[model samples]
Target: MFCPKCKSEYIEGYTHCKKCDVDLVDELPEEPDEYEDAPSIDPVKIRYAPNAIDAEMAMDLLRQNNIPCFSKHSESGGYMSIYMGFSVYGEDIYVDRNNAQAALDVLNDWDIVQGALGEDPDELEEPDSPEAPDEPDESYDNAPSYTRRRTAARVFAVYFAASIILASLFGALIMLLDILLD
Candidate 1:
């Protein structure tokens, strides 16, 4: 006897495969080759998310619509997430080229539905280009990057300070308990 699921051969008396929990058959069907009849899956980027949460949400949406998708974190994103709580560089979501259009459609539909529910679609639309200033503004040029760097530094500082304070408190508590017990 043979188990179709696990492809395990058994004695004639054995009626099922214990591991696969499938009924045994007299003969097993021929297994197809790994690449046989399989469509070539070339991943195409569908969306760029600012963080892991957005990337996960997009991936989940695609999966619900039966589209297979995956995420690629930027080099900095992966490392930054380990140090920080989340990535700052963001992630790129990809889907098979064959399903790219369908995946986009699904995402677009989701966006429209979400907009209808509460969000303003017009506010969601990004401006084509910023209005040019008559005179160059040095402060404006560095504003965004400066703000991001300052914010990140502040966050790191706060985390480091909090950890140190907590550790000190914990150590003090432990010493107090030891003295009391002694």
Candidate 2:
């Protein structure tokens, strides 16, 4: 047979080009299905629907109030779908079926719901306490005040000056003694 690309004579029944190394036979394969379906799974139930920060705060408050609670998706690997292609689930709080109502009551009583919702609840009003007016005492006004001692720099300078004076005095005494002995 003759190679169509190079025009070179090849032996009969040759499957590839001898010069260009091109496959004489077609090498295309069948296309795969793109719309393959996946098996369906069951949806999870929500025991509590606290928002992300509120849920975490509720969980901590529940634990502090002695009601055992945990995040939902963290316990069961199930996520909550909020919108189309947008889902949030990890931070939602959850408790056992028995303690769910009690947890809600504790959160309500502590004003945590309003705090988590970014609003001040009616129960958060400050209590008025009766006390004497705050004023400065007059006894300490005439008392002698103590000041901080000198820093290391000033002490070092004084010591350095004293040492120089002492050294000069000793040197002058030694020179007088040498002159008298001479």
Candidate 3:
């Protein structure tokens, strides 16, 4: 079955979600009496106490373990808004009341493993140290600089004069060609 939160798949008999820590069982107490003499106990719904992700993960785990599980959202919107906005309010996972405790135990085991690891799986790694500041180059700063305004103007003038001369030469050649043709 796929994890409702992370969408990760699990095999049958899986108790806890490997990717997310969520209980896959229902843990509510059984009804006090089937007969009229005893007061009836309300069925316990499997719910994620904290986040929708957790609830979805728990449902996925339950499905993998061959337990059918479903999400009960008070609001009709998607899971994110239901849990994130507190639209669902109380429990996030609703399982058969009978399976609640077993699911919780599975989740607890996963939590223990996470605690032993001493770090969150989702946490980003920090750099070992801040980057060193770039050093200023004194040699370049001390280098001599030249103004190119005069040089550029001189180059432009030379190019203009050459173009004029070339144009005149071309015109002369064309005139000669016309005379010869005539």
Off by over 4 Å in 1: 1-39, 123-143, 146-182
Clashing pairs in 1: none
**Once superposed on the true structure, which residue ranges of model 2 sit more than 4 Å away at CA?**
1-50, 74-91, 112-182
The positional error of residue 181 in candidate 3, measured at the CA in angstroms, is: 69
> In what order do the candidates fall by lDDT, top score first?
1, 3, 2
In terms of TM-score, how similar is model 2 to the real structure? 0.28
Each prediction's whole-model lDDT (CA): 0.76, 0.52, 0.53
The residue ranges of model 3 lying beyond 4 angstroms of the native Cα positions read 1-43, 74-91, 119-182
In candidate 2, what residue range of length 10 has the lowest lDDT sum? 125-134
| Order by TM-score, highest first | 1, 3, 2
Q: TM-score winner between 1 and 3, please give it.
A: 1
Candidate 3 on 19-69: residue-level lDDT in tens?
688644433334466576864433445443444676666667777776655
lDDT of 1 by residue, 43-147 (tens): 777776767997898899889889998998854567667877787667878888788788878877877887899999874522111122224335755677535
Q: Which lDDT value does model 2 have at 24?
A: 59
Tens digit of per-residue lDDT, candidate 2, span 1-182: 55556666666678789578866543334447755565333322223442356556666777888977666543222422332122232344555656656765775566755666776665352211112232433754654342111232345447778999999999999999999999
- What lDDT does model 3 reach? 0.53
Name the best candidate (by lDDT). Answer: 1
TM-score head-to-head 1 vs 2, winner: 1
